[model samples]
Target: MVSLKSLFDLSGKKALVTGGSRGLGLQIAEALGEQGAELVLSSRKASDLEKAQAHLAGRGISAKWIAADNSRDDDISRLVDDALGKLGRIDILVNNAGATWGAPTEDHPIDAWDKVMTLNIRSLFLLSQQIGKRSMIPNRYGRIINLASIAGLLGSTSTTQTIAYNTSKGAVVNFTRALAGSWGRYGITVNALAPGMFPSKMTKGTIEQVGMEKLTAGVPLQRIGDEDDLKGAAVLFASEAGKHITGQILCVDGGLTAVLSSS
Candidate 1:
């Protein structure tokens, strides 16, 4: 019988988290690092990475940082290379870097749509391909945690006009499912976290525009996610505890989706 602590222990595991400099990415990074995973945090800004590294250090978690823009093919390649160099090989890959544009479906800019799709979906493929080929597949063990949004699950509401964001995340839902099916034979587990409305750089504009009270009004919990909300789920997926769980999309949205399903 596997002990609970042993199952959840991530000691000596090496992880790479894209967009780890802030917001949801940073929160997940902190969770993984605290569980004894050695980490490489990546983002577009070197300065932000520095601050994140310091923040992790203050928490007694050591982490390495590589600055790369996840949206660009070249930068994505370099990020994988640098991360492998730092950590020897990645046991876990967290594809958290993403972008969104708030525009109506008909008036959305093509370039903006491309940007969202490229970072949210394309980058996940590129990084997973390289990392799987170079590391996880060869090792026959890996855990992939994708950052999906509740926007992916629901249709457009009157308060929001982010067509591209919703569409790209919806693609992520299928992508997570498809990849898990393809990669499970290789001993790799792939899953996604679908967060409802968390206060972050990405959602700040939407929250401000929609108003916090209105956003929380319909949620069964009457609040948005807080800092520590995603930690347990993240650690579970990254550790042996979740070895048997794959292709699942766990929503951490304060029962917003539950309300949606019932109403």
Candidate 2:
């Protein structure tokens, strides 16, 4: 019989999470740490990374933090090198770092589009390539979870106004499929998680401006995603439970994607 603990155990695994200083990334890092994986968290801000590292340490989870902007090629290389130096091996990678800008497609600034595409799509692919080629492919074992969004799978009304973000996330979903197909033979599983209406620093301002009722009312579940919602998905993808799952986008959207509401 397979024990529950054995199914979720990551006792000796080393995991790296980019943009892990706060919000969904931090939550995922905490979840993986609790599951017994040595964690290395990275973000652009040093102070935020230190604070997050302390929070994880207080939970008795050993964690290290690195400050690096994912948009820079050199920084991306340094991040992978630094993580490998500290953890010896990267058994799992959570590509949770991303950014978004709100602007109408017609009026969107060129810089905003460039920034979002570079960080959200290009950087994610580059970092995944570095980890897959340099370590996981050689070792023949690794789990990669890319953080996608509901925006990728469905269209938002005009009020949201983030075409670039939506486009980049769509790329993420397809990228996961392509990578998984190519790497599965090497014992690597690549997947994506599309979260819906999570209240984080990224969405706090929007929620405050638009009001929670307006947001929750649209979701079929009538509630926003919580930290608990992330734990199971993260653990499953990173543990034995998801060994056979690959090239799929798991939507943790509280039934938001299932319903077509004219509200």
Candidate 3:
């Protein structure tokens, strides 16, 4: 019988986390690394990647960093190639690089919308395609975790307007399910994490704009997500413990989505 601890262990597994320089992406990286997965972290900024690498090293979690603009096709190709060259194989992938532009739907800029979609959803597909075809499919095993959002599951609020971000993440949710069905025959499990208010660079502005009290007021748990809130869920989806799980979107929202569902 497989021990529970052993089921969650990711020893010897190699993982690639996009947008790993900070925010929720880094949290997930910490999760996988702590579970003994070898890590390759990627983002657009060399400085941020360097900082993240040092941060991980401080915790004794070995990590390699790559700086690349995943919004472009060439960069996506290069990222996959370089990651594979360095790690030899990618057993888990975390699609976490995303951006948001806040504006009323009528005033939302077309260029900004394109930017969010390209990075959030397009890059995810390209990287997953390259890695799945080049490694997981050939090896017959893989775990792909896409970063979605509670916003995707619900519409925008009066306090916030992120049309592009919400649409793209909704796409990510379905993308996770569709990809899982398509790839499960090859032993690849695809899942998504739909997170709520996590304090990070990307969310700092929203929290500030919406006010922390207002943000947490409606949440059943009455608080924003802490640094470690997502760790366990991320590891579960990335390790053997979740081998039988696929096409599921686990929300780390402190019961926010549940409240919305019942209301």
Candidate 4:
């Protein structure tokens, strides 16, 4: 019988988290690191990566950061190569680097739409391809965690218009399922986390625009996702405990999606 502690332990595992300089990416990095997984964090801004590295160091979590723009193909290729060179092999890949644009559908800019889709979805595919072919497939074991959103499961609100972000995230949902189906042959488990209203730089505008009271009211839990809300879910999908689970999207939304589903 496998003890729960042993099942959840990730000691000796190596992880690479994209967009890990801040927000949910950083949170997930904390989770993996606390579980004893060696970590490599990547993002566009060196400054932010420095701060994140310092924070992790304060917690005694060993981590290294590679600054690269996931929106650019060249950068993503280099990021994967750099991570591979440093870590020897990547046991976990967190596809968390993303961007968003908010505008009425009719008035949305084409450039903005492209930017969001390319970074949110395209980079995810490119990085996964490199990591899977070079590392996971060869090793026959891996965990891939994609960061999706509750917005992917539902349409945009009247007040907040993000057609590009929504469409891209919706793609992430199906992408998770599709990839899982194809990759399970190699002992790789592909999963996604569709988070709800979390207070972050990305959701700050929407939260302010929609009002906290209304947002919480719609959630059955009557509260918003907090700093540590996503930690457990992230660790579950990244560790041995979730070995049997694949192609699943676990929402960390404090019951917001559930409320919407019923109503």
Candidate 5:
């Protein structure tokens, strides 16, 4: 019989998490670190990354911080190179770096659309491509977990009109499928995690303006997602248990996508 602990253990694996300074990326990094993976975390701000590294170390996890901006090609290249140099290998990659902009369809700025697309879609693909081409492809073993959104799977009734965000996330879903299909034979698995409403720096202001009760009322589970919500799915994908699963979008939304009424 397979021991459950063994199935989830990542004793010697090396993981690189983009945008891991705070919010969902940090949460995912913490989860992966708890599972015994050596982590290389990157984000835009050096100060925030240092603080995050300290926090992870306090939890008894080995972590390294690299200041990187995903929006720039040079920064992304340096990030991958730095991780490879420090960690020796990147067995797992969590492309959780993303950006969002909101505006009415009619008034949305072209620059905002470009920004969202570049960060959320273009950079994600480029980074993943680099990791695969330079590291994972040669090793013939890799696990990639993309941070997609329920916004990609379904439409939202919320007041914010995030047209570019929705479009970018939708692209992410398809990209996961395409990459998974192509890389499966190479012993690589590409998948996506679609999250529902969660409280983070991104949503804090929105929740404050709309109130928690109102937000919770729309979730079928009657609550927003928490840090714990990010752990199980991540462990699944990164562990031996999820080896057979690929090219799929696992929705972590609280039944919000399944049920018509979130009320």
Candidate 6:
């Protein structure tokens, strides 16, 4: 019988997290690292990566970082290679690099749409393929977590105009399911996290613009997510506790998705 501690232990795991310099990515990194997983973090900003590296080290987590723009294929390739070089084999991967453009549907820019799709979906595919082919498939063991959003679960709202972001994440939901089906034969599990409103750099402007109370009023929890809220869910997907779970999107929302919109 597996001990309770053993079920959640991630010691000896080598993990990679994109966009790990800040926001949800950083939070997930902390979760994995705290569970004894050696981590490799990547993002576009070297300064942010440096800070994140220092932050993790300060917490006694062994971490390495790479500066790469996930939207670029060449950079993604380099990132995977460098990550493998640093970690040797990636047992877990967190795809969290994403971009969003908020504009009226009629006025949304084509370039912005392309930008969101490229980072949120295309880059995730490229990195997952590289890592899976190089490590997971051969070893017959891996855990993959994608960062999705509640917007993907529903259509665009009049108040928030992020058509491209919504579409990209909707695609991510299915992508996780489809990939999980293909990779299960190799003992790999793929899952996604659909987080609600959390105060992060990415959502700060939108939260402030819309007002936190207004944004969370529909939620049963009646509050915004704090820094520690996502760590447990993230750890579950990356550890043995979730070994049998795959192709599922776990929403970390404050019961917002459970309630039907009055409209």
Clashing residue pair totals per candidate (backbone < 3 A)? 0, 0, 0, 0, 0, 0
lDDT of 6 by residue, 16-62 (tens): 99999988999999999999999999999999999999999999997
Summing lDDT over every window of 10 consecutive residues in candidate 3, give the lowest-scoring window.
Answer: 154-163
Residue 241 Cα positional deviation in candidate 5, in Å, after optimal superposition = 0.9
Listed in order, each prediction's TM-score against the native is 0.98, 0.97, 0.99, 0.98, 0.96, 0.98
- Per-residue CA lDDT of candidate 5, range 1-263, in tens? 88988999988999999999998999999999999999999999999999999988898887998999999989999998999999988999999989988788888999999989989989988899999999999999999999999988766345868888989999999999999999999999999999988888877877898898887786678988997898889989988889999999988888888885443
* Model 2: lowest-lDDT 10 consecutive positions: 254-263
lDDT for each of the candidates? 0.93, 0.92, 0.94, 0.94, 0.90, 0.93
- Model 6 TM-score relative to the real fold: 0.98
Model 3: colliding residue pairs: none
Can you write out model 1's per-residue Cα lDDT over 192-241, one digit (the tens) per residue? 99999999998888788879999999888999998999999999999999
Model 6, which residues run further than 4 Å from truth? Answer: 261-263
Residue range 1-263, candidate 2, lDDT tens digits: 89988999999999999989988998999899999999999999999999999989898988998899999999999999999999988999999999999987789999999999999989998999999888999999999999999999877458999899999999999999999999999999999999998989889878998898888886878899987788889999999989999999988888888885333
lDDT of 4 by residue, 143-198 (tens): 99999998899897656688899899999999999999999999999999999888
RMSD of 3: 0.7
Measured with C-alpha atoms, the lDDT of residue 212 in candidate 5 is 80
- Which has the better TM-score: candidate 2, or candidate 4? 4
Off by over 4 Å in 5: 156-158, 261-263
